[model samples]
Target: MQWAYLLGLVAAATAGHVSIPFSRQDYSASAALVKRQASKDITLEALNNLTGGGYYSEFSIGTPPQKVSFLLDTGSSDTWVNSVDADICNNQQLQATLGTCLTTFNQSNSSTYQLVSSDGFDIKYLDNTEISGDYFNDTVHLGSVSIKNQQLGLALQSVRPTGIMGLGLSANVATREKYKTIVDNLVDQGFIDRAAFSLYLNDLESDSGTVLFGAIDQKKFIGNLSVLPLRPRQLATRSHHSMSGYWALTC
Candidate 1:
């Protein structure tokens, strides 16, 4: 079953979890401790945009790692980042007032970035946001856990300014062919055990929340984690692509 807590942080799923400490002080790693004694746990920060916009994560990409912040999207299937050539990121006057396109990926700067397809990546969101760009694989670091050679999209042209890290299913991807989602790669790469994640937004007043990938923290909720079956898309026809990797209706 899909839960609301799925949007926080992409945490580790293992017997011994790595806890990456984050805070509102300066969005720095104040403490990063891996607890082998704990059953399963990780503490990565997901800062809320104070205006009640949503949560975003501070992560790094590239060989040496370039810092970037991404909007944590739960419904989006294709994970993508803003390219240095993107209109919003390049022409700062467009949305200059908002300053949303601040972070971008310069493929040439990353020694590990490998271009897979020049024009194979394309995705559209329910909000009418469209992003089209080249597909590439690079090293992405979430706190201390590094996902090497992870496939992601580099948006050359984007309707949205900020990049997004999609946690949706592989079948929901808009690529030429279905590819493994980030969660899937985590398990295959021996970082996590399962392709499951849970979100825990501490409270409305809190500065940040947590997202646990692969393992569920039983202490957050009441009795048990409800297993909600994926209901077939009823809001639109089978031709609709926006409904992919999402629950038809909330339980």
Candidate 2:
């Protein structure tokens, strides 16, 4: 059976020769998938994760590029980071690596950082963990390209410290209006011709994978990719509307 390739990205400027790295370490299905359709370019990049089958990508936030690691989750739509002043990143949370929110985003040093909102940013996980923080707009560097005034959550209180780089569709974004998700901003800023991407994961031994944005890596996969329409009706019915945040398709 043929599988559909997953899509997501970090917004930036320019188009050709754009690529980034995704880092993580876990044992899961590790295979590459490429997409081509209606004449649009597909970009590719690597991901990184330490354990528990999670994947992360590298992006430079703020003016001088304070490099940060974020879990590339297409299932959700709000991208957030833990602030250094947050009390949630305690010693106990640091010890337990599983579901532990690591890394504190220092917003003060960012020359381009701007506070957009002071309230109503919250997210609750299945395990009863949650986070609440203010919203801010800043520059995000994807490889050498730069995307200006992108919205991101600056967490002040969170059950976990690890931040999330949400790639969900803009229509389904959980945050307030006047801003765009990572994928949406990419299309609006001309970083990619279309708002689509592909995800690839390596085997347990290799612990490596790639996520393509506006261009695909032909060397990663063989055979033509079959495009699957997003089946919201079927998926919503199956999920009972609870898990409808993802780009669900009835393939």
Candidate 3:
């Protein structure tokens, strides 16, 4: 399991749902062809929970299955859920950990549970509290996908939103241990093309959301494009240090 603290950035303003087109009308036929060629079908589903501010979907855990509403986060690695029996007053760290004493989910009782070491980083939140714990390998079910031996962060307490599913392509403890994001795992398993996945987050008070797995709607384009360099794997060197500053900006 991976642990992380909430960064206190003001939530991005919600502008309702805006459809992004894959191409602009002024673009030449060639450009339109290229744009269409790059598109794929991506499937997404809306999720709901009893919690007032629930996101679009429920993530499943354990053999019997404990479902928790979670946000799909690309910026972090690890998945966690709020504990039903969390002791908030006695344990401040429990506040930042998902699946604390208040939730019904119990990891300790799961037969397939195994704990991995934390990276020693004190994950802090806006509440000025930190949580510490080792990662865990377990079965994770998201939407129609079921991934066994998934790496996730299991905290002793519960914090903002019940949980998170990290979808970044970076190689971290979770990824190295064969735990992959839903999209990545799908691509690896040849269920979807590598570049076919795209996320369209519709920030609605009702917690409505959508995702496209194999293709996107053609009518959603506005005709803007920016090409960025994909990172190439290489041995650590002096040159790597120079690029670190730029990489941090993107993150």
Best by lDDT: 1
lDDT of 2 by residue, 1-251 (tens): 22226533223312543466676644322232111211233112222222225677778899888877777776678888888877666556443533454467799999999998886677764333567888999998887678889999888886444688887776555564736887667767887766777665554444456666666665555676555566555354532664445677554
Task: Give the candidate number with the greatest TM-score.
Answer: 2
Compared with the true structure, all predictions reach lDDT values of 0.65, 0.64, 0.43
Candidate 3 residues 1-251, lDDT tens each?
11111221112212221211111111112334334433532112211111112233556777767776555544444455544443442465533332223333467776776665554222342122344345666776655666576656665544343455554443442324444655555556554444233444333232343554544433333443333344444334443522321112222
TM-scores, in order shown? Answer: 0.75, 0.76, 0.53
TM-score of 3: 0.53
Worst 10 residues of 3 by lDDT: 19-28
Per-residue lDDT of 144 in model 2: 64
- Give a tens-digit lDDT track for model 1, residues 113-160: 999889888886543346798999999887568888888998988755
Over 4 Å off, model 2: 1-4, 7-17, 26-52, 90-102, 176-178, 202-204, 232-239, 242-245
The candidate with the higher TM-score, 2 or 3, is 2
Model 1's alpha-carbon lDDT is: 0.65
